[model samples]
Target chain A: MEKTTHVTSELNINNIKSFLEDIESFIFDCDGVLWRADEAVENAAQTIAFLREQGKKVIFLTNNSTKTRNDFLHKIKSFGIDCNIDEVFSSSYGAQVYLSKINFQQKLFMIGEKGLEEELRPLGLEIIKNFEKTNDGIDNVQHIEPDHSIGAVIIGMDTSYTYQKGVYAHKLLAENPNILFIATNTDPSYPVKNGKSLPGAGSIVTMIATSTGRKPNAIMGKPEQLLLDLILESHSLNRAKTCVVGDRMDTDILFGVRGNTKTLLVYTGVTKKEELPSFEYQPQYDTRTIGDLFTLFQKL
Target chain B: MEKTTHVTSELNINNIKSFLEDIESFIFDCDGVLWRADEAVENAAQTIAFLREQGKKVIFLTNNSTKTRNDFLHKIKSFGIDCNIDEVFSSSYGAQVYLSKINFQQKLFMIGEKGLEEELRPLGLEIIKNFEKTNDGIDNVQHIEPDHSIGAVIIGMDTSYTYQKGVYAHKLLAENPNILFIATNTDPSYPVKNGKSLPGAGSIVTMIATSTGRKPNAIMGKPEQLLLDLILESHSLNRAKTCVVGDRMDTDILFGVRGNTKTLLVYTGVTKKEELPSFEYQPQYDTRTIGDLFTLFQKL
Candidate 1:
């Protein structure tokens, strides 16, 4: 649990001023709000520019584990929004921070892509290929065995995943009760080519967690507070001033409500307009679309 | 919904005699009562033989979709039990029957292995690779597609599955609101080479069904009356003379309750002995073990 303390500028007037008066730093959800299914939202770049002119610091946050921060920054730039790599906060980075905090020492068995591994390596954790690597007397080719030395199991998206991996993870979890389980995100689906979607790492994490009866220690993405805490920590921003603005209520709005930050729901991404009135926790600001936020800001 | 018709047989003696006085046939759950995992229960063969000697027809019913009727028959024979292939009933067989009843024409996008597909082919249903295969120039692989042309979506055990398969299933389900969703079994776990496991086809079916908001048309496996109906249809066995004996309450005892047949719970498999007395629905005859049932029959 991290303390929330960011303060927004009182003199700033945005079009959504009536709803988001005290908001300063903006946290944007990448997948749906900023861009959707390989297409950037219309006027998305201009709106980001307008927010920057208003002296609001922006952070691109995403629960998607498939793409690294550098990859996301590149994609965001391609979408016509100028953003630095440091302004990106991914769930994978949060996972690394979480692992570092807990001081988990065992060889990591990652079920994710290279980005996830890159984040965890800074903590001096070695990634073991398989459970066979733990075996001491094995004369065979490079084998990853679970020798009761591994400290935690980390799961992320791996397209080449197999049933054997799940079985091995189950075995390791069953063998070591103290071992921690960490997941990057819990989004069930991710965008693919031609507007199609694929089952993300969340599905695999769900499978392993459900089977082992061991809930993950933490999910480092939006809807979870880990990434938000890391963002505030890195920028020395107070939580109250830093409002999370995005499209999806489950991730963006929930993150705001959980962190006690003002939330702005933009109807430009995954969430539909009709879904707002029924949300359990209402957002501080509700705009017809993200592009509308720019017009509202100008009026304010 | 199926009718629960109480069946009675003359084999019930003393305190249990009245319940069996009118039973003419016997239904037995294969997995637990007849066999544990892949091992046959001791004297289980003799008990079925004795029931046959008493002019009681036996139906070996199971919810496990990994094996077909012929496979079950051979396995039973190897355990020294004489069972006809026709006497065995599986959920896959029932799903095929359900599909045939509706005159399904389009190739089935089967999410199962060879056994499930083999069962469906005899029903004149064509088997498509996946929803991706239907991507002809006309279909266009868009966000929304029509699924009325699809005959059915049959799900079963698929160990060599990928995320793409799940995505395709999700796409097909989203496309056709009226497409039939059929699952082989609802067993959460299956016996693997190591031990009890998570995610058989039933688990996958559950995930897809939950996501799509569609209930399966019919589950033909154990605990469902469809398999029982098939057994009764094949053997011409009267409901009044049949009894279902097995270990698992949800599958075996519930099957008997649904079919209105006598249920004998043999404590030699999945269900533990301590769990019997507190069960909400009590089996007609509670044997200490499967061997005890044969000993009692031999004494009679």
Candidate 2:
């Protein structure tokens, strides 16, 4: 394989066991490492249970903005994995926390799904408009001048994305240079069933960026420090003893490198073994799957 | 007052007669110079008629894509100006000629008003979809995958632009890297009635560029050399003897500068005297208005 050096340099079972022994807390990415779409990866549930049984703090972190924290908790529980709502750190959840932390008081203009709205609405944050919820006929479309009341623009993935929404957001940002612009995640696309993918939140965010010529102040997702900071905030996580686990090298491994935490790459998701050399940054450790980590637990 | 140097150095009425004596042909930008919105500028008609009486080859050009050549001729006639339809050059007309020059055989996916479609259809070109003509209920929207038959994407201003239309164009360009990407113009916005403006073709084009990460191959409008090329192609224009007259420094004057044509800036619309010095390139001549040129004709 092209990545022979990195592949052969991976920690052996004994080395992995020693590394696990030093880890005081763990952060796990939910999608590719533990489950694909609606199906759980083989032995993934048991592997997490084994880590929890060892008395290590565990948290589920994901960049998927389509789901609320409760939705993630429900999905995680159905996989026979014990996940509290507080342990979930979805991008929408992270956005909610970040907005609250900054004490954002103005009306939030959004180009996102109901999940994102659900996260912000309960906190008493006012949204400028919800096109999907309005369900107005296309004939009812009207050109509105820029409204000065809009204070921030937040974007997430919505199956119902429209040009009118893009225009309204663009006009607002163009009129007010100080508006707080934020995107929940910038993943190029997300995998669907049958190995197909749909344009992700990042693509939608890009549309807004192209229109307004402005980048988001914060992208609340993996590889961005905001999510990591939120995960460690409540848990009092020690970066030196924290191990971040995920399937993708770009989002997960790079996330760990940036945070100074150990990272383990599982092959059950996006990245392949042969693709390692192509990346400028490599994971600290990589194995066949999340279940492979069980060997370390058995040895302990 | 800020542009005093450029203004003072500009040819006076006596000097203007000498300058006009050498001009064999002229390309005139329509809006803001000869007219503002739907109203003609004072003496604009007589100035142009005087130029024609001097046996000068004159062409009426505009970057506005909302009108066809016939539409322009009609508007010009309404202004009490004798103009031939063949002497009018609109962004839509330029796009039609460009596609024909390239021998384009595949269907064009358009994001524009009916005027754009009207120009291309007469040239035996087929359009993929018209967002306005469909008149489908917005609630009945469905996602259709990229169609390979779409060989080019052409964008202009469209009040009916939808997110679905933007995504479809993006997917086509993303999937087929070689698909000819073209836009009518990149004017940030177009002026409407009551001194207001709305987002223009550039905004819609920017959305696709942001989504696909590709700039247009040909933006068929002012400030680009393509339009100048089109103007000169039929007339066998001598760049040295050709004079370009307009009101805006950014588009019209810049177009002339880039094309190596002598340019005359009229202060009737858009660019004010204070804004001229900010431009790196200056027009060769400046006057109070287009009617000021008629004074040169009278002196002769």
Candidate 3:
């Protein structure tokens, strides 16, 4: 196929294995490289098992803010993949950490999924004006009251995203420029089953950005250094020895390149082989899929 | 006292009067200049009357997409300001004209106020899915359906702006790159009663822009030449003899400056006299308020 002819120049099984020899740690993106929805990638669980057997430390990093570290851990374990709760670094987990790092003790306004709220609320933060949580039969923006005590506004993917929320957030951010704006992830949309994708945290964040004319003070997802900082802080990760692997180039490969970590892009997720030429960042290695990496592992 | 001290350098009553001597046509911004909400600005109607009595043509121009030309005409008449329907130009009115100019004949999707819909629907265009119109008690995005018949997505300020509407628009635009995306205006917020402002059409427009990663094909409002083109085409407007009077420098003054017409900034609206030094665009004259310009009109 075209993919074989395309990647033949710079990538092959032998070259990929030789490149992995010096890499002591392997960072795997959960969504596309390991599993899509409930189904695991072909031979992906075996690939991680083989890597673990080879004394290579494996880490699961994701920009998905819908899930907390515990949620991701449970999902990873169900797939027969070995993962510790501490080994999982998700944007939702990073959000609470980021807030704690900044010492933001004031009330928090959340516009994300339940998992994001779950990870954040445990930080002992008071939730502001549950206007959204308590609908109160109010469909009008004027009826939607404002909470002056709100200090930071955090956003992720919410199935219950509404226009009323956008207006209220706009009013708060506009009136008080001192409010801390945080975006858990700016992925415009996340892919679902059957090739259909729904709006992501970025879609909600963008609505606020348009209304308030402000960007997030801190972005807690991949492509940003915050997640990598969290991953590196706990573990003695060497930029040269740790290889970052993911499906997307913009978020995964770029994150690695920016952090000086070796990156290997897999074909199991969002990006394609042909797209590698168009992107500003290039992965050190790419294969047919994450399953292909398992084949190299079997040879050794 | 602060404003008087601020304008002593490049603005004065004698200097302002001399600059207005050569102007034959006056283009006035409706909001903050002529009126604020239901109440007319102090002496704004008298200023227009004085200018009209002096044989000068006065036209009402506004970037507010929430109102149609006819609606503005009524509002202008309510304040005892003499104005023909043709003299009133709003962003919503310009939007229909822009669409017709491009010969766009297809089903449309909208995420704006009722006035924008009123101005646009009269063009005889078939509207796409009515998920918003017929809410059907469905709050979830997955339950929301898509319409393939959509050819263009127009945005204004929708009081009913919901996350569901934003998601559907994002889906249609993402699926079809050929779809026309238009923004009625980019005014961030409009000043409301008691010094408070609500999110404007631009907030809704920005949300879609973020969701789709695309800018509008045409922005029909102040500071853009489209409105001026429509104004010039309809009337015998000589750019050199025309002067645009308004309170906001970013929109009204910037619009006039770009159109090669003289600009006069007034203190009756959003901008302050002290802030004039920081802006890139400068008006030929600045006074305490629009009523100050009427003072020189009496000398004739």
Candidate 4:
């Protein structure tokens, strides 16, 4: 394996305070950074509080499309962290930002649950008056009629994902070739309750892409600059002062790098300590856990 | 897009006779060639009857893993074509063929319906006493406890496929990295009815593969010689004298090409005439429909 090309700096007491002082905004990725599954990461809540106390912009920018912005707020709040609805930015929220970008007028055919719908509905985007009521008794056998008004197909993490939903999305995309196809995020699987994981929207997005023989026209998640752009545009945070702390390198670190923001990698989630060199994108600073940052700020 | 590298010859009155004369065994893809979703092609039954009269050993080889060999036999028989149980080969059959190759002792964790199970159950391969009874009430949130007895996980097309199934498959493959991950076939979509298509086993297979971060150890379906190998070994058919006819290039034609059998492309299914020149794999003979062949053999 090729060695890491960039000089990967390990955060220490000597270099930590000075490097941290430059960062005004802290964009943390959830699931691994602040919490994993339902449990909050130890001292991670304290670290966020400490940053906020120091007048730093703490925004939870996540590629996980499973929850709405409000749901995300509740989860973080339950963890004893004070969070506003505005501070939460999910891949699901990217649909609103992306749809408004194209000035999309027609209805959207979605392959996601309430999280995706909740985010998009706020933008006055019609969701095509879909499933649950439509696909009541019959689950997979019910054939969804093609709605001519559908202009785009947006896919995100769906717990109730079925073959019927996939096939319908495939049919709509196939017939209406010009429709905007956008993927919320493409994280294969997110870390769940145990060491186990659930399939992420990326898996579903890729499955459709594989079958449809077409990739998303625009990816609305991290590493693609959409979610970060949502954060930047909404918060009006200076890119130079924004530091993205995340668990995965492909999404988190890469997202920060693409947005011209500083990146910090934590090891409590997907990306590990030794696996850092193997990744193409190197972070500016990396620590074993977010609690390590808590220790530094505690001493200060 | 670049033009086709090889000269793709169209089957005509002169070339068709010569091409038809060279082949002894006829391997037909059922979905597009013989039938399309419970309806038989216009003169496809007559074509099969005509070929059989000319002493051609007819075989229906399909990448569709949704049906067992017996189910396939019944479907063809229902279409007024003579077909033996041995002549019908499906991608699901590859599970039995592949298991016997590995001499797989432990139980299998399957992600398919009765057709896939029915095929493997006959092989005396224990199917881990799977779902329907277990995941009865809860659909997506069913927490399936892992069975350590599982030695492999095989997937095929399933209408009742859920997100829970995808997550479980991802979990199993993740925990048991050494498990034999065999995909029946990886055709993205298959035509069902009303010019629309259903998501193929390939989509589900690809979904799990994406989430698991691993590809199938062996793909049992078309383009891979496993299904064709099963047909060749069981029937003792000569590969050189065999001609494989189908609608799709990636699966059907590529399967024949890889198996060292003559490939004939028909436009009755997924592959179109104009799209043939763009495909990487070129067939030996191209016809508008299988009926064109019936016309040639009708005179004989």
Question: What digit string (tens of lDDT, one per residue) describes model 1 on residues B1-300?
Answer: 433333322233353444435567777777667777667788888877866776667777767665666777888888899888777777777777777777777767777766677777797656775444333111222333434456667777666455556656767775577777788987755544323453555556755664455677767777778878777777787776777888787678878877777777777666776775555666666665666645654455
**Clashing pairs counted in every model:** 32, 1, 2, 0
Q: lDDT (0-100) at residue B72 of candidate 2?
A: 89
Give interface RMSD (Å), model 4.
Answer: 4.2
Better of 2 and 3 by TM-score: 3
Residue-level lDDT tens digits of model 4 in A88-189:
988888888888887888888888877778889877867853554344212245366667678999898887787777777887777678987889989887
CA RMSD of all predictions: 6.2, 5.6, 5.1, 3.6
Best by lDDT: 4
Candidate 2 residues lying further than 4 Å off, grouped into runs, are A1-23, A36-43, A77-80, A130-143, A187-199, A212-218, A222-224, A240-300, B1-22, B38-43, B77-82, B130-143, B193-196, B214-217, B244-254, B263-300
Question: Which window of ten consecutive residues has the lowest lDDT sum in model 4 chain A?
Answer: A133-142
* lDDT per model vs. reference: 0.69, 0.79, 0.78, 0.80
TM-score list, all predictions:
0.84, 0.80, 0.89, 0.89
The candidate that wins on DockQ is 4
**Which regions of candidate 4 deviate over 4 angstroms?**
A1-5, A38-42, A125-142, A297-300, B1-6, B37-43, B128-142, B297-300
Q: Tell me model 3's lDDT, rounded to 2 decimals.
A: 0.78
**C-alpha lDDT of residue A186 in model 2:** 84
Candidate ordering by lDDT (highest first):
4, 2, 3, 1
* lDDT by residue for model 4 (B154-232), tens: 8888777777777667777887888778898888876656777767788899999988899999888888887887788
